[model samples]
Target chain A: MCAKDETSRPKMAKPGRSFTTLLFFVCCLLCLLLTRGQKDERMSICHLSSCGSPLADDGKVYGMCQGRHGLQVWGRCCVNVTENTHNFTVGLDLSGCNIHDEFFQESPLLTLTHLQALVLDNNPITVLSSEAVAGLTELNYISVPTHSNCSCPGGEEAWNHLIRSVNTTLCLKQTSTCTRYNEACPASSSHCVEDGPGLFLCLCKEGYHGYKCLRQGTFPMSAFLAGLGSSTVILAAVLWVLLRRHVKTA
Target chain B: MASISQMWRQLKSKYSIYHVFVFLLTFFSYAFFHATRKTFSNIKTTISSEWTPQFCNATEPCLRPEKIWMARHLFDSSSDAEPFLGWLDSTFLISYAVGLYISGVLGDRFDMRKVLSLGMCLSAIVVFVFGCLTEWIHLYSQPVYVILFVLNGLLQSTGWPCVVAIMGNWFGKSTRGLVLGAWSACASVGNIIGALLVSQVLDYGYEYAFLVTSAVLFAGGIINFFALVPSPKEVGLPEPEDGDDDDDDSEPSGEEDENGVTPRTPLVQTDTDPPVTFTQTRPQAISFFQAVLLPGVIPYSLSYACLKLVNYSFFFWLPFYLHSQYGWKETVADEISIYYDVGGIIGGMIGGYLSDRMKKRAPTVVTMLLLALPSLWGYSASPNNKTINAVLMAVAGFFIGGPANLISSAISADLGRQDLIKGNSEALSTVTGIVDGTGSVGASVGQIVVPLLHKQLHLDWHWVFYFFILMTLLTAVCILPLLVREVRSMKCFLNYQLRRQAAALVQDTHRPHSLNS
Candidate 1:
């Protein structure tokens, strides 16, 4: 009778168990689809515009896009495809793109954290504030229209060299934004460090932690040493006893 | 009361008790010395940041800014303290290399226990004053730091030769490889201890790190001064037998006599046959020139230098490489780099055991070094996988560090008591110093060259790995002659064993026929 009941229980629960199993698979499928959609949205930035037949000579940006290995030109952008999954935008040439101050304020280019060489020559943009290049820490070479009065992101002092040519004003070697915000960390136990262009972070000193860096104290050295010392003594005594027979005495 | 007295007498009579005591005392003494040395590297970043003038502001106002009011204010505008720190390191290395030669001569002449304890105590005080007292007193002078580091380097130089000499006196050649291999892990252990102690106290102030390490080192020095037994003769125990007579016990019977490779001349008679009065004669210490011309000293020293260059490059640059390449946080990178040292400790033990089993040091060292090339190359080529990187780094570390440890500890001990030295244990300290001093110079050169290759020359980071591979290859090349000799001796030994077994089998068959006749 017990065997018959056990055999019948599976028959009775099969439909409901199958239904839950189907639901679990459906939920997993939905998660995969959502992640795939997000990935597509991220990759769409590369295909937003088409590349010109003869790429405009934007100096370093053009050279990087054309000459660098593992980097391919994709719709006016030089994307790094070395990792296969994550395509980092390393160089972007936006010559004659009709970009303005508004485009700098809320452009897709701001999402490219790894952007190094950016060319915005022949654009309508006149003034580029520090906020416009806020997250671009790796940027070393940037070009603006020659008519623009916008100095470098953190001003001329923050850059190594500034060149004014016929079509563009190029800023080379943008030093860290920490140079301008050197005194940002006000607490005695904190220091300001550069995170990116126009970005700074406050880090607590070594022993100090928690809110405003007030917490302090060192490792429990006394307790630790006592434990280590006692264990060593015991082990040494054991070794002495074990090797007694082997030792040659006078 | 009677039982307690009897037990005390029994313990005192056993020579093993003294052996254990000396091992523990010397082990901790050297570990303390290394811990103090390691503290500087661990706290370098904190020191550099504190040195920067910009660190002085409204709220954090640099501690005693008036103290640093010099005419030049060299670090006033620039936030980078790397170049100054580099100069400090170079100053220490230069002084340390020079001091090692002098310390070697002094160690053989003086009581080793006194020399070791005094050096440790003095170095502790210097470190404490340089690191901790200066912070308390608000003394911030560049020249003063340089002077203190130079002094500290000379004092620290006394540590290695004295400890190695003392160890050579206590341990005989039979188990020297296994014993010293295990013992040599003090350096890596010291590094870990320093890092832990510093990390614990760094948040309060960098000075606390120095304070703790110096205190520990000072305590070790005091203990060593009171309890250390420098040699067996000091306590009226029998001197250990050198490998000359015991070689046959561990190997085939006829090998040593037939090949005449290693001279079995018992220069110092063992206590086994007749009780020789040790007080009647003492072996004189060899000079620097004489020690240098010893059979295996020059090649081993050169090999050690090349091996140390590669070892120290990883020691100095591993964290920086991890942070830059993998974008790991500073602390994470530092923690990950420790796996290399862990691999080193294991490798040293294995290398020692293998050399002891084969009764050959050079072959084991050369094999590990040759294997290191591929591990290094694999480490460089492995894609940004943390597990793979760590495993390969450990493998590279094993291959590199195994031979380096063997050469410095057991090989140094072996070379010191070689047949040419005539069992004059007094020369042990000088031989150890020459090898280690040359290795320190090589490490200094590496510190300069590693930075030059990647930073100054503006080459890719991969160039550093290529240079490491080259260094590993050079280390093997330097030990090639030693490897050849060891291999030839081993072949001869094996042939003798095979012939003896064949003769025994023929004798077994002829015994029955003779009985029937």
Candidate 2:
């Protein structure tokens, strides 16, 4: 087999050994190399019909699409935006829509945590807790301001602090949820500091912190006892099984 | 004492021990093959995202290019990177297809254990080097990436034939369909693992995808080297009766019984005879063309080509289509697409089990391919509901996965044992290689054509799916001749039996008349 291969090798190398063959190979190589450098054109979310309301809709707000006018919008609704929203959807403008609490609850916006600028400028929406607005740490520009009726559990002072931490220029004030302060802070808490007419801050005496000052700071003795009991039971069961096997063998 | 003794006995049993080792070692070894290949899709996405840095930057200025796609000038000069990336995949696949043929030949002549392990190790080294070029050193040459991928493709080709041939040696024809079916799921398992690994590490650095995958391949190679026994004889166990052992002069004389049949050496020795020392020779290697000429080889090969085309198109493009057509988030699209593979795992087992029970490989495959046509059409035309899509994807997966697994593994094994080959066991690997090699060519074509079809159809995903529906129908058609032949043989068999019964009745009447006379 080795001798046969050796004889065959020289025969192949002897023939078709021309400059043109080498040139043809080089040309093919060149074409592939040239084509490799080419890059695909970037796709824009603004071009997609799912990014904006259809033109046939009764209320065609330019703000919904960031004032990019004259773009063609077919009759495709953004029905499955969580599954349909483009990865590059940074600026979402739902400014003039009457988006109530149900809108937030039902909308797929929560899944689009990659958003950079979320503008709910003039909507009649009230945020009751930081929990409602959490998980979107990637947001650079959030505009749910006092003017838009957007408020949190913490009053104007707390809202301002939230805005500062997010590093956005949106100034949202405390809402009616703060005015009903008796129910806001837990009864077992120590002091409630009112910043404004509608806003109050809870100050727990000790061994407690949180929005309602309801969370106990100390570790739970019951959980410790339960863990200890379970471990002991498991250990005892294992030992019993081992002992039974050993006794039988003996 | 009784419990301990029982436990030890169970461990010493054949079905409970050695066979399980062979099954797992082969299963994971092939899965590693798929795991390494699975990284391509994720890497493709990374390349596209990186090429459009300006767009990504506009979305979020802080976002950086994936290190895997940071190789300069590869996609920077062109208007679209899809064409180039498609070609890169094609280069790998074409080389792979070519390498499959060569590897099959080598596997026949050489020790499969070494071939498979060395292939894995080389594949690991190539992938590791490829990753380092992209991530650590940032080597920015198109030729470098292309050449490395092509090399990896050739190395990757060695896995399927070697594992299949080794598996064929252990399990008999009776249980082959079911065993191979379960075993074939390594591809889907590897796909899930690869997809998950890339997605998880994608945020950290794209290079880790390749780095981690290379590590897996290396570990698999090491395992393959140590754990894999190419044939049952290597471990002093009985080779399954495939009717080929008579022609196999490779076994030492000491192992042969009085009738000259080598009795199956039990995996665990019950008798206290001293361990037999035997020098076993290898069966003569069959030629490539001869292996291809074996009965059922050509038709199955052609059919497998089409099946692979459809399957691989989904493997590479399903996520991209979901993302683009429905405007789905990349991650969500990736998650949803795994349903296809999940469906495939179940489909493979079903296909294998059905074929085994029916004892007709071609007809079983034909049924699967026929069923798959409607599933593809339904999936394409169905609404973009997640639950509906999930159901449809699984159903499609079952039908397609069944035939794909059946034809390549069990059917190939059956064909390799055809009387035309004189039951030469060494030819099984070569036949497997030829059939799957042909399929890999279709896979290569799929990698190229799917993208082109997507381009030609103006990026409408519906038309792309229509093409798949057509391919499924074509695959069913390829198996029609085989199904026809099986039916005819069955009819002939029935006719012969009826004639013999009629003759026996006549003989009974004539005997009574003669006795009376």
Candidate 3:
């Protein structure tokens, strides 16, 4: 018999189909949420190796990965540089590197504005200089920690001094000493603050503030906060209906 | 009520040609819907390229545009990339399979016109919105961008069911193949448009092209809303009442079903003829949740997924294959591949015409599919050599693309039996959704699996053609028996009985093909 029934639904259906339907929707919601959750996860990665440094496309670079020697381009290139948008971090896993200026020229800690960290713990970074870090004004952490026999004139001390010169408020000095000297040092560019040795923090420059401290905003905090509150409730209501009713059906 | 109604009987009035007018209008509406639905498939290159520089290529610039989910993939590891592509495709396929069961229920329970229109509008909006998203959001991870495209797939699922519902309502047994085949051809046409337009836009900017294509579907949505009429009954007319003048038996009172609930006409009417019937009202509507469980939906849904795997693989990979195997760029490869679509247009017309004339749309699909299987082999084995493979591929396109529409459109129509079921044409769309959604799942599968196989086979990307060949063969063999039943349903196939009835005229070999029965 041709049992392709159009007239009536099968009576006494088991609970199995419903379970499947529920599972199906659960998967869809999870996919949507997971995709939404991974917004700004970085695509640039530095594979740690002994001889090779991650290739940076050369000094006058439009794309960061353009000149890096060992660095491979992945799915799509995400870095397009602009005035206020440079949150990409250049990580140095010198756990096994014989550091040459190719490291500096390629990732010349100087050019990166929002450079966050530089780690050369187990590397032979014998000759370090300020010119090597020509453009890196906004570096926060430069850990060359635990050197058995360190180089450079002041060793860690000269590096500390370099951090201090970048911003008078920033130094290799202890926090207690810095707090005492705070009054003596006039905050010239209030946007700049010293964080560590050869590292200072850049306060989102000005007229711009977002998650990565990237996007520019027109309104102030109080007005934006008020707008946020009303919209939050509305967004919540809409999400609830979409997730609850439509999710169940869609 | 209106003067138009009152004056209608006085004016030169015959409801039959009005049937023809509605038929033509409905057919065109279905065609336009197909055109718009297809607008997105071709633009893969554009959207992929546009989102590329913005997203950091996750690993490499301009990899596979076929990998819908990999738009979110972030790592540069090729090892990780291939497997993840596979996983993502599985995700899409699983969701598609899950979605299929309920799609039928949704169409049946809801007003299919509104449902289909809403789906198109939303798809357009989602695609357009996703297009605009290239400008706004810049989250560059495997998870982030993948979600956007996944949503795109989910929304796109609505198109098949909607179009199917429309096609089912408008055609019947005699012309089902021809009509459905034409509808499927529209799908190919949409892809062709999608490929050309997307490539063109990508050359300029990826964002604008995506936005434009997505937004254009709104036009289709609007047309579908005004143009889709459920059946002839919706406009206060009867079926085309073809009233062919050669009936010998005393006629049954066709008027008996005027109350709109018609019983199934018994098969005893003639063992020598393909049964002909007219539209009768459906018993009632089933709710969306309960519709999938209504038997045959899941089985058909599974077969649809299998059938789609071959087709979808071709959809996503054909351009890339052409480019890699031949010395061609993405744009050139994509453009040239459209010849396949052109052949599809011809194949669909031919298949449909044959099916309608012979009353065996399903068999036409089986036959073309069988022909396509070896063509896939020929295409895969000899892609570079022009004399053999290129011609073979065009031939493959003819059969493959032709049958695709014939089965999906006319077969779905025959399955719906709108003539038997009456006003419940809405479920037809849901069944369509289930079928096409199943196919989308397969497409996602092919997108992932073909690439993985290509890598494994270590053959130059010709593995895509190979995959199509194997799958096409399997699908053909599996559906061949279905064709046997399909042939028997043909009024012409009952040759022994027809010859017995007209022994005097039996030797007359000059019977017009149209009157073979």
Interface RMSD of each: 9.6, 18.2, 19.2
Expressed as tens digits, the lDDT of each residue in B193-241 for candidate 1 is 8888787777767887898888788767766665676766654355554
Please give, for residues A35-83, the per-residue lDDT of candidate 3 as tens digits. 4422123322233335364433321121434455432232222132222
Clash counts for all predictions? 3, 8, 36
* Candidate 1 lDDT over residue span A83-140, tens digit each: 6445677887777666778776554656777889878777787887766776677888
* Candidate 3 segments exceeding 4 Å error: A1-250, B1-97, B139-142, B199-204, B239-283, B286-303, B383-389, B418-426, B457-467, B488-500, B503-517
Model 2: residues >4 Å from true position, as ranges?
Answer: A1-250, B1-16, B45-74, B77-80, B243-267, B270-279, B422-425, B457-460, B494-517
Candidate 1 chain B lDDT trough over 10 residues, lowest sum: B63-72
Order candidates by TM-score, high to low. Answer: 1, 2, 3
- When 1 and 3 are scored with DockQ, the better candidate is 1
Predictions' DockQ, in order: 0.04, 0.01, 0.01
The residue-by-residue lDDT of candidate 3 on B1-517, one tens digit each, is 6877645642223223323433443443344334433443444333333233223242222211123212443454444454555555556556555555455556666666667667677766766655556445755456754675466556555555655665555444555566556556555555545545555544334444565555446655554555455454443334422211123122223322341232122212233432234334444654443445534445445555666787666665677777777777776766667666766667888988986665555577777887887777766766465445446667877878776665566666555553334444345665666566666676677766776788666765555666677777766766666666556544544665576568746545546544776
lDDT of the structure predicted as candidate 2: 0.64
lDDT of 3: 0.49
Q: Under the 3 Å rule for N, CA and C atoms, how many clashes does model 2 have?
A: 8
Docking class of 3: incorrect
